[model samples]
Target: MKIRNIFKGILIGVPIGVTLIDSLGYVARVDGISMQPALNPDQDQTDYVLLNKWAVKSYQVQRGDIIALISPKDPSLNIIKRIVGVQGDIIETIGYKNHIVRIPEGHCWVEGDHTGHSMDSNNFGPVSLGLITAKATCIVWPPSRWQFLSSSLPESRLPLNLSPPTLLYSA
Candidate 1:
């Protein structure tokens, strides 16, 4: 009887924890140097960042927001990248096959701060909104690294033209 109760408690606790993490936010360890000065900044120790899921639930991601998404080529993996272009905006690709691309409906273009080292939209193309898991709101760990990540796209990365009706659709 005790064992059964313990099992029940674990099952309930697990889901609650997962839901809280999904709805609220959680800290994740940075494994690579893709984000450069914005993230790890160093080669020795890593940083743990707070990823906010609440902010992304509306699918209203803005340019320069650091977001986490399930990799398109490999759905099993999750990658962190900055939003370079939103739907309806025309973006000039970096190393992508095409020189310029208009972010398709329900999709957004992502890129890494360290251009050459990171694998982002330049490699796999724009990602669907459904694939985005969360937004990196701030760096929570490491006292020296604590700060809110602001929305500020590099001037070179901005789209050439902004479409007036990005969210419009005709049924």
Candidate 2:
């Protein structure tokens, strides 16, 4: 009886915990220095960021937003980067094969703060919207480092065309 009750409790608690983390958000430790000063500022201490799953549910992510996505080259790996260009925008590549690329429909170009160390869209090209998992809203841990991650793209990394694509509606 005791063993059965313990197993039942585990089943209930596990789902609830996972659901909360999936629907709401959760803190994750910063692994690398790709995000640089914005994330793992100190060498010894790693920051924990609050990734907001609810925000990306619609896949309406904007330029400059910090997002977590499944790596195109390897589906099992997850990488965090900033959106440099969205669908329909023409962007200039860095180390990618093409010198210039037009962001495809339902795709976005992403890059890391520490450009050289990170492997982002610049390496594998634009990522499909379906690959995105969540948006990094803020750095929640490290009392002294708490801050909302702003959506600001570096001037040097801005897309060639800043205009939005035209959409036609038919009834």
Clashing pairs in 1: none
lDDT of 1 by residue, 1-171 (tens): 999999999999999999999798888887798888788999887888888989898999999899988989898988888999999999999889999999999999999899889999999999999999899988877888899988778777889795233556878
Estimate the TM-score of every prediction: 0.85, 0.86
Candidate 2 regions off by >4 Å?
A: 1-11, 163-171
C-alpha lDDT of residue 92 in model 2 = 85
- Winning candidate number (TM-score): 2
**Native-referenced Cα lDDT, model 1:** 0.89
Cα lDDT of all candidates, in order?
A: 0.89, 0.89
- Writing each residue's lDDT as its tens digit, candidate 2 over 1-171 gives 999999999999999999999898888777898888678978888888898989999999999999988889988888888999999999988889999999999999999998888989878998999999999999988998889999998788888786444467867
Global fold similarity of model 2 (TM-score): 0.86
Per candidate, the number of residue pairs that clash is 0, 0
